[model samples]
Target: MVAGRSGNTQLVAALDRKASALGLYVGQPLANARAMVPALRVVAEDAPADAKLLARIADWCDRYTPFVALDPPRGLLLDVSGVGHLFDGEQALLDRIRAELRRQGFAVRGAMASTALAARALARHRDGCVVAPGDESKAVAPLPIEALDLDEPATHAFRRAGLKTIGQAAGRKRAELTARFGSRLVYMIDTALARANAPISPRRPLPDYRAERNFAEPVATEDIIRQTLLALAGALSELLEKRGEGARRLEAVFFRADGIVRRIAVEAGAPLREPNAMVRLFHEKLAALADPLDPGFGFDLIRLCADRIGRAEAEAQQLDSDAGRERELRLLVDRLAARFGRDRILAFHPCDTNIPEHAFALLPAQHAGPAERPWKKLRGAKEAPRRPLRLFARPERLGLLRAVDGRYHMRWRNTQRLLTRIEGPERIAMEWWRSAEPTRDYYRVEDENGRRFWLCRDAQSGQWSVQGGFA
Candidate 1:
């Protein structure tokens, strides 16, 4: 099965052993492939899904080493330097990884070297290779120049100069190579030979506290997994308390046997140190997943980590119940956020704008606590014009408004009513420097039925609209 953009129908990207034996090669046109074998089948390319699967595979590789990085398109880089001895040596670890993936039904190739570039090149080009420390150059010398991953023009120049193998290119003078092909070729050769260096960026942030469990046999039941999480959370809580900090965000990673990884993340509305609270939050997060987690063939390793932390300290007992009430409220917020999503639970924060519509903004509850930004009181008046309990998102237009000798009469919702009382002519001007907007004179008017409405009249147009109503 394969895909390409040569035509609308399809093109070959890969083929099975039978197809290869019958002379079908990758990048061969689909029309040509079908002609070769009438029974050939082709499928559409799902690049995004493939990329996601690749990411999951990278997550699973964390079981081997925390320093796993993506190599893009379809590859991964694992920095197994200090960790390889855990499996009894680099060779044993590589063999174990290969055997596990193969058992999970994937065709895998692996190689190890002192440098990431050399290891990646060998994995893609050579097979079953182990370039011992200080021997990277000798091992990759015989491989083709393509292993350097040079641009096509540079590769063609190298070929034209009769430098076909990496060894031949290595033999040339560095200054001479730079003069002919620019500094890129020189730098690439140095990197491939482990003479130059680069770094691998891990997919996730390194945690402050990490506790992991590796099983002799894979564990599949959800209850058992929860029990593991409970234990890890207990250990993590103790660590956080000793450090005088609390976890604000935590991540639980399950490494399945079949190269699939499932991750559950939970965030706390306030700094959280209780292990039981953390466990409950994770349960809510896992239950809210749109796709139920499946432990296919079971998980071989599970790790718990505190991804985000914050300073926390024990507070003195309050004379009143205010502190207890605040704690309870934050706990409720955390639970609701875990179930309904963080964005779904929000708190209003004041914005630096006078216009009612632009006066405030909503932020996630976990991000914007009640005290994050204090509410600003209107200037000048001790008893300001009472704002409606509920303000309209946009003011509703009124059909007819008339003032009868200081008293008001208005037609609203197909009914005419005489306003018994009127309180304001609060004038608010638009920020003229920002935009051209009409100034408004707002009035609190009470109708015959005693229902009070906030009405705004455009000073320029003399048109009135009902903005909101008091409770």
Candidate 2:
């Protein structure tokens, strides 16, 4: 019997009696569904919630095998090659999954076969059928052609021509089928019969090394978690060393008693296989978390995965005496970033431009280094007319008293600062496509006290402002 809710008494009674209740054959529209039964309740589909539930199910299915991927929108594809025997055969494994999902309040159907196509067909059309390794064709043969997940138009076309069962389609010559229905139908049939292979691509790639620890009791203290993480890092380092590789990224997952998983990821500048370094990096990251690690009742499981691996590289120690000074500088920057945020620490890199304002760019100190002269070979690579070491994030405007011979004198911050020298009034035209266009004539000037400043005159308004200062 088809155990599903329906508004129409005729369709529901027909489905209950197992009398060809093709869900596709109902031919009732939503408006019609409501007209048939005024008391019928309809609900919108919750796709995201369904997807998250499927992901949780896939994680639970990891006990069966590590190779599990979502069949998308619905269903899951599990690679149960050599692992099925551990559960006492494919049927037992399928039964186990079905029972477990049922216990978890899910209405599930399962099928096991030598190929994914056969399994998908059997699961959708013949739920109870279990196709042995070499008997995929025989198992799929009795099922309807619609089991192939064909489009509605194609299904209707096939049905109109009296080709219903897969066995009937299989009886026809491959050349005839391809000529009549196109290559897609032929390909689907071939794949379902195991004559062609269909592979499943996982959403997430498998990690290189995975280590898990299930605690007898939950622990929430940072000290204990750090110690446990150190141990896991040591074990992971050993694995990488044996493989002659190093991990570029490490992910630590803490599975709490409440069933929520918290993940922390660490990325290394270089591939790393040092246990202490890995633990230290994670410790630094953990110390920066805003939320307290409440561990609630306690964490049940802790899993560490090395995601990206690369060939291990050997480093040679520098003989220069300045090595210690470099290390001290790095340590200072790391501490400042840890406390004040990495954005607060900045480095400057030269840009390819003659304009003083565009001569350099600011970048995060953690990811940027001192500007180098590697591009010295490029034409016009020389530094532009000396720019101020300190530039305001934005130019501050000042009300000028007067323009003496095209030289403006101004008062800023309630202090009198004179523009002693002036250079060419270099006009920068605006890109009109974008709004707020500005035309400015810039000048390099020095105050009486030998302080150099970069000032610009707004040509349109005849207003002057100090853009930057040389420290």
Candidate 3:
């Protein structure tokens, strides 16, 4: 049994069959529950761990069908509509799912119907009910009003009006229900009667293209897994080639026999259509996994999916080596990114900002799109760089010292350096649309030891500071 805080008081959150038989229901106040059974065993509820376990269970359901959605706290919805025949029939598919999950020690209860809401109601009330086509209305007609899963106020209103069963409440006119208990109750009735369909949002996006291999017997050998991956990648490549499209993001899903699903994803710098390249990325990703993929009892199923895709236009055979070199560079970036991480390998993309710190943005090279603007050069090609190589986040103030014949002089870093030369005072104004900022007069000055320093003077405050350094 589990107990947690609900409002200002601790309440019973969950309990097993034995607790249920003992008349300790969920949502009962903790004090009352303890009084009812003096020796009742209760443990604190860990919501995070429970949610994670539910998510893992949803991942495990992917082998049965890709259209799996979570139904919070303790329920899962699987849209196995057209895929039911693969597991023999609808009844067999449901039975197999229940049997497998029960074998793994999960209290399973599920149902199937035309609408998601109808199935949800049945799963909660009828448990193992399977409503045939055009039978949703009849199947859910006998369930109590609580099966509709309405709010407390709405449920009480229905009960007060002597509406006990779902059939009784659904019998009322739609306009009356909408005007009284509100549209939610009306919609629930509509869906329970199969007059409307409620869509279930899948936990993950549907892949554009997919290939899978299901084994009759679980295989644990390393060579066998490698061969299976290559085979699946080849099959997926053929499909991509037929459509003249390549994948930028690819994911490989491994379903372990013990209901554990391992998913590995890799991204390419450009559209990749070659099977060898795709498999190579997966190999690098697997090798870099901190927690190595454990094949407990081997994997019964392996699936490869192209999550993001782009056009794979045929490139003309080039006579020069430049094109080949470009392709090799892209492949290298992809491999390195897979081994390390996508964010670890980045490229500078120009931003449309005059501020030195905001001039360029470092984005992941593997998935970064083209930048909008080009990098503006401060000096002409072949000329000395006008901007400093290193810029400080915040300029450090410099103290001025009266100079005579040696030209400009300043006290910086607890030392005074004699300035040999000073360049033009480049005036820069802040953007008007942004917050008000003072104008700056920048100067490129060379010190006595041939070191250059970037200095800026505030026009408003008449203050001098070092902004950057070239040495």
Candidate 4:
């Protein structure tokens, strides 16, 4: 029983066979119910708790199929299109679902039809309902107009016009009904009778590949579980190799005997296909979990799925020893990343831009391939390192003056420094599309102490600053 408007206690929201037999209906006043039955027990309604339990029940249904949706207030929809054959047939599958949910202390009602709306209506309104493919309109005719979920005004209008059952509404002119009440009513009836299309939305992403093992008796030993995972990985790897593709992310789901499910996931730094390598990565991932996986009461089923996939080209044995060495080095890096973490290992990638500060960026080592375009060099110049070995994040200002002899003199940090020789005025203008900073004229200068320094003069401000240093 729950509270109604004006703080008055209302009728029961739900009741069993005995209460119904005693002439008690849902939404009936609680005071009237107690008067009808002197000795009665009642509990407060908890909408949130009921919704949470329903969600968990929907999750448990994933062992059957990944496409499970909730029909709020109390209903669940499972689109078992291709999965029905796995459990023998549609009737047998429905029976299994009902039996399992009933065993878990739920009063479950199930029905199957060609359309979701028809199946839902049958499950709610009829017992043991299974509508044949072509018999939808006949089967739905007996149900009331309220089954279409029309608004209160429309339902009252239908009742006032002597339309009580679906048959009465369907017998009327389709054009008149659509014109009077809009297309929603017509669409609802069409959907309910399998005339219109209704699609199911899955709660989880469909995996690229999935493999499952169902044990006659639950098994919980760690060694056996690990072996099972390795076997599944081997099979999946073989499948991937045949398609010339590899998995970038994999997930393992352990469905326990007591209706509890646990999932462990691992991400690959690169496209991976080797059976042994995949197993090793999962081992490392499982070991690194903050909370160790517990196979409480054993697991009745285990499934391995490839969540993300990518193309993997089969490489021929390299003839050059250097190429072979590079391959080995990459393999080592992949192994290290698998054991520690992906972000812990990184490499610099050249960015396609003219600005010196935006020339390169750090990316994951596994994905750090050469840029689309190589860095442009000076025209007719030999390959040489022009940029300084160490560039400061920001240039430091220097108090310097150009002498009459075209030489530079500066006193930095209270120490006198003289430029004995200079190399260039490699002018680099600021990328106006990116920033409004002034242009700079860069020069490679050697001080009297033989230390090579990179200096720049801001063209707009005429200010000098030290940018970098050479070895």
Candidate 5:
């Protein structure tokens, strides 16, 4: 028996079958139970341990269905809508889940119904029950009002009003229930009767595509693990191809026999559909883990899931072609991103700004979406590029002079430069709302050495500096 503090006295939080049969029940005062049976064994209740154990069981249940939701204290809600046929039927699937959980040393009670409330009520009163569609109200009508899990006072009020069964309470008008028991109670009833829907909040997001392999005997061999991933990737690829989609992010979930789960994820800059390419990314990710994926006591299940999917259609291509080259570069980026951290590998995103330095920002390539603004080509086709290929981190001061014939001369980096020509002073204004920064003018100048430079002049201070250089 597990005892925990309840009010001023200790009460039994839980009990074993033997303790239950000995006339000791949960919520019974521990002192009273000890008085009833002097030799009764007792242990302290561990709420945290219980919660962690439930979480682990939920993770293990991912093998059965991705739509697994926690039902708190000791319940798990699984939405196995289209997957029942895989295990034969609803009854068979229910039996299998319970049997496997029992094998893992858990005493589980489960029921299926059209609604979660109905299922909860049935699981508590009618274990192993599978209510057919639209029969939830009829099925639960005979159970007591306590079946709804009402608080003690509410249950007492219903009993005082001579409503002994669920059918009796549900027969009352909605208005009366609201006036006395409140809307929450009415909602509970409505959901239990399948007249309303209560969506379960799943613990994890549903994957776009999924494939798995379950081994009868646990296997820890790296070769087998690798082969399993390859096969699952192939299966997933087939599914993705049928829908003209590919995975932007893929996760491999390893389920160890001992209820330990390890999930390793890899992301691609572009949609990835090739099985070989997907496997290679996982290889790099697994190899680069600071703490290696430990197959403690071997893994019984291996699942590959495409968490984030993107459009990918078959196209004619050549290895030397531009499209093929782009694909190769994207694949290379994915590999590099997996080896290093995604954040550590960055790409430039164009920002919608006129300031040269603020025009682009570095973001993680794998996660960065389309740029807010596209790169603008400053010069027209067949014309010299307006922006410099290389911009200095900070502008360098320069001495400038104009000759009588309108030619220019400049001294930069302590070297005198005889300019052949100088472009007009293209004016650029500073952001007025932000600061008191002065407006500036820019010029493109070429020296006698056939080198070009982008120079800027301070509008108010009359200071000149070389801002950047052209390649």
Candidate 6:
């Protein structure tokens, strides 16, 4: 689950507080943390688990505010602009959030400021809610320059030259600081102090249109459901047309009186505004739902939202116009995807690699369309020799008999093929430091049917396998 080598090691190093304390004295590399304290233990980090945890927290925070941004490696940013009044006050809200996080076993620090950078810096360097509005400069004036998130070497250089506090650095002439530390330092300072606008980029953009319909009574019939969906789609389509755009991703959420919400998403092959088509698409998706649409004391509300959208293009008409046909084909694919599962419908696209097994990737049909890569021009250029047309996701073992003369012959489906053409003894070594190491000698072979295949012999096990086939 670890993303990179450094991140893996850093997580392990962080857990060893004793070693970290000793290494904090003078100049010490992270690798030397174990040397300072011999019993220090380390393990690879799990980035996927971390990301999943952050995502769950983000979802849970929706009760507070819909505006949440993930701060990778740690933390999340919530914009409680107009919504803070509902929770009594800003401090009360922060305390409640902190208490909830504590109950969930998360050690957290909360801060509020006029700007994001100021909030982040204050939270990192000082106590909870370190700086309030209009007090950023006063709060950050005495903090060390390192709180600015400057690079280690730059910080060290600054400290060596006797500029320790942020106030000292801020006191210097703007031009002199810009010339010495480059624009990045100046920008960070200005952003932190609220002189420049610093924006938070959300992991996913907020949905554009949201429409909710409250029913007088629960409706369990398919006809009623379809009717309601059509109405919502019509409203959404009209809203999109006004903006000169069409919906690409749509979500339909049904909320029952019992508070359970069932949501289904549909993605269009192209931006679409047709209400009938959208309703039909959802019908296809809902038909396959395993959970019954139980009224459960009566349904309350049904909401429709557009997650992604794009500009609508003017249609071109021709005698042999395939646009209509293409639309039908895409709709057919969407229905099939909803029924048989999305992974069943796939497309193959070329990858930038000479290795046959790495030369193509399978992409979902819903997301894959005509790409503009110039494959012919790329193939014509001088580069590594082209690979085969077909490659197995993983090689299949082939039984081979070695002759006394140091040659080999293979048998496939009771048919023997002699070692007539052989091209390589290319050897690849294993990465000893990592898990699941492999070492192989690959070769190109031609059979009596004029077919060519790339094969490899495992150096460690002495087993031969067929990896790929040429066009």
- Highest TM-score: which candidate? 3
CA error at residue 241 for candidate 5, angstroms? 1.3
Q: Kindly list the per-residue Cα lDDT of model 5 for residues 131-179, writing each as its tens digit.
A: 8897988998888999898999999999999999888999999899999
Model 6, 261-293: lDDT tens digits are: 566888776787888988888987777778756
TM-score of 5: 0.77
Stretches of candidate 3 exceeding 4 Å from the true structure: 160-162, 216-223, 316-321, 350-362, 367-383, 390-417, 461-465, 469-471
Clashing pairs in 4: 11-28
Q: Candidate 5 clash total?
A: 0
Residue-level lDDT of model 4, residues 1-471, one tens digit each, is 342322565658777777778888876788888899877677767778889888888878888987788888788888887887899987888899899989988888888877788788788778466677889888888888877667789999999999999878988999999999998888778888888868877767878887888888999998989889988998898889899999888889888888888887777756778777777777887787778788888998888899899998886668568866776666666666766777878887778776665677778787776566765654356744567778888888888867898788875657768989787788888989888988889888889988888888899998888888877
Tens-digit lDDT string for candidate 2 (293-339) = 56887787777889998897554445455864664455455545544
Error of 1 at 410 (Å): 3.2
- Candidate 3 lDDT over residue span 218-247, tens digit each: 988878888898898899999998999998
Models 1 onward score TM values of 0.85, 0.73, 0.87, 0.75, 0.77, 0.50
lDDT of 2 at 443: 72
Q: Which of candidates 2 and 3 reaches a greater TM-score?
A: 3
Better of 2 and 6 by TM-score: 2
Give me the displacement of residue 187 in model 1, in angstroms: 1.4
TM-score, prediction 2: 0.73
| Comparison by lDDT, 2 against 4, better one | 4
Per-model lDDT: 0.83, 0.73, 0.88, 0.80, 0.90, 0.73
- Ranked by TM-score, the better of candidates 1 and 6 is 1
Residue 79 miss distance in model 2 (angstroms): 4.1
Name the lDDT value of residue 312 in candidate 2: 75
